[model samples]
Target: MSLRQRPLQASNSTSRTTSEPPGQPTNPTQPNCHPSTPPRKGIRLNRILGRIVPIILLIYIAFAYDLVVVRYAHRHLYLQRRRTLLPIVWLLPAHGLFLWSLRAYLRVFFAHSPQYTNKSSGLISWLRTNFGAAFPDPDEAQQLEQQRLNTLATSLSNTEVKIELCQADGQPLRCWRDNCRARLKAFRMRHCGDCGTCRVGFDHHCAWFDNDVTAPATLRAFVAFLASIPPLYVIAFGPLFPSAWHTLKQIKDFTASDAVIRSKWYNKWYSWIGGPAFRWIVGYALRASRWPKPSKDRWPHESPRTPVLVALGAVFVFVATALAASSLTQLRRAMLTVDLERAKAYGKLRLQMEKLEKLTNGSDVEKLTAIRQKMETLSPTQYFKVSTKDKNSGEEKESIVALSPEEGLLSRGSAWANIGRFLGLKQASSSDGPAWLLSEPALRKILQAAALLPRENSN
Candidate 1:
């Protein structure tokens, strides 16, 4: 009996020990046992914030502009001043700027091309057609693709954009199979995951525009849209303070008038709905109201608009001016917002590469190759010429460097030249076109003859 009891006790103890290890979870089968709750909550919070912030900003801007400019400023301007035939001239360039800005904003916010539409005829059928379309005749497909690319290049060149292939030591370097196919299909094109569409020279997916802002065609419109806001605000509210002051005086005088209290319409309405409750409600509203009290002091040129409205208008003007200045700087540098973002990423990668190189004494070919591969992935189109020195021999060795376009690896020409190209004064050209096609320099001279009018002139 003792031997049997001892064996049973030993077996039970061994089973208990095997089932539960030290400092381990008692119930591993439970789904909530793992500590993954905080990360998921954080992700959800971020997603919510990302959407809410943009909506809040847009709503605030709309409300501010409506109150300060349209409702208050315009009304005061018309009330105080007599109407004139050339009232359009009052907002120097703002009315015109507003129109152009609105046009460009519409272009960016809405579809500039039919390809941006999501209304598919048949999703399954379209997928089936495209899936097997490449199978029938590979050579024929390639040739047709080449022609399409050439046509696209010609169109861009006519618009005054300078697109070129990656050159190594003054010679055009060939790309890998996938990149070569991409080049043939659409030069420097990228598919946007957020937009779920392929855009040429894909810059970035803009949540504000709810679209992808890309190169060649839409870039000018985007810049114009940014450039238009400041002037539009100036034209709309340049005389806001004066008009608001006049409106305040008018309101004060009207409210204080014996005629307003004793008017037949007011007397009839007061009699129809007279009570202590109504009087109390009216008293509360008067106290709660933000409207300014009547002032005894008068200025030479007092505006009829509200002081609050004038302050808001001024704030909007300052904000627009700041945004305009930054946008103009980006234009002069020929740098897209996306480009600036990419530059930051490229700089980070360079720092990492330098650290890795130092760790391996700059001789770890495999690590160097991995870093280079990442750099290439970020900016597939731009190229750089880099030099590194040998630690032992101090000899300099040159290699073709691949950096993201955000890093500005390519030439932006002069500020005026870039502006010219952006304004369509210069033509878009690409070296990715067929070898038989005319070179960029030669085409530039010829295409400049048919330059479009500058943006300001058209407006």
Candidate 2:
């Protein structure tokens, strides 16, 4: 059972004893043992900043331009009437296009459902017909996970792959339950606790998207969606002031007279809903009541909307630029955020193992065992079958090969090859079926690295 399914027991069920192993702290709250939840307040604030702030900025840009700039400028500013139409000319098409894109993106994001391994499941069948299905029910996901784990276990000997296991605190080497990795010729679908499903090429579960973004089937769409948004922001905000200025003249002429405005029959309803806010703000502004006293009007003696809109646009550009840069980097690397992080973790784990080897006596069995235990905790180890044919008999025999993160260089490949994999290309051979594979060059390098590992193990 996963940690989520594990039932909570009485506090006294696991008793603490003073006679614990030396050099090993008995505290379960150690940094490496259990990760802590971030402060709730900070998390809430970040969510507001990331999601709500952009919305607020967008709303502010609209109101600041219309209410403050256009409305007031027509009455006071000395700019030509044609120049006053700039903001309207610029914002209309750009904003309209962005809204349309956002609508389409939302449709894709929330509507797209993932395909699970179990084709027999009713949910999967339904999803095949209706790609808009958001996600599988929790019970269904749990069932699918059980089936996946069962299948993975049956393919491996003893439901686990055994390797040399050791820990820094003098733990002996042994075959560990949690250390077993996938040895089958299947997609390495990682079970995400947060997403509550096994996602192929699993990436980070983005709270912004509120979905499990993977790199297999959905990667191209995901990247394309990401690549589209930043440009929209650029178009909208990059020429924020210029658009406002270009359309200034038209806005000035339209508002030059106090002529009563009437909306088209189709847009009457929309105007009815939105017109009240405009009326209220205008009435309040003209009354000199200054409901929001010491407002932008009190300072600068010039068009306050100019600076305010510029500031809003600048903030938007900064955020969009960062996201664009990050998405581009991920695209170029051809790895999901989670996959990249896992690769980095592998490098760190290998470094730690090397350091341990350098510090310990080469001939000490106990020390070596301790090192193996540490290795087991860092990542899973799997036993794969490598077939060889005897030349004389023309008979094939299979030998089991144990591989771990350090020795198994499957996901990390040349950028181009990784990109091919990300784009849903399969490199299946008739003999191997659909096994996870590394580039030939990467495989050769990994074999060379694996060859050196035994020397350290012997030492």
Across 1-459, the per-residue lDDT of candidate 1 in tens digits comes to: 000000000111100101222225335443212332111122333344546745764675576556544544354344444444334456546556666766675565554334313354575445433321111122343454445434534544333222222232212222222112222222234444444334444555655455556654555566666666666666665655456666655655554564534343334556447576675345323432533443435432343334544555566567656755665576566655555666667578789999988898889988887666555444324332222333455444333333333433332456764454433343433322321122233233222322311112424
Cα distance off (Å), candidate 1, residue 247: 11
Best candidate, lDDT: 1
Model 2 spans with C-alpha error above 4 angstroms: 1-93, 107-185, 242-316, 330-333, 353-459
Clashes (backbone N, CA, C under 3 Å), per candidate, total 19, 25
How well is each residue in 1-459 modelled by candidate 2, as lDDT tens digits?
011111111112111212332345435542223332322232433344446644664586576546443453443332333455665665567667666655544533453444342443576455444443243333343344345333433433322211111222212222111221221112234545443344444555554445555655445445555555556656554644554454443334444432333222212455445477665344323332212333443322133345446555566556656765675477455445665555566567677667767776456666666544444433433333222333455444322334444553454545555555664456622322212233333333322333311123334
The positional error of residue 177 in candidate 2, measured at the CA in angstroms, is: 13
lDDT of each: 0.43, 0.42
Model 1 clashing-pair count:
19
Query: Candidate 2 has what TM-score?
Result: 0.45
Give RMSD (Å) of candidate 2 vs. truth. Answer: 15.2
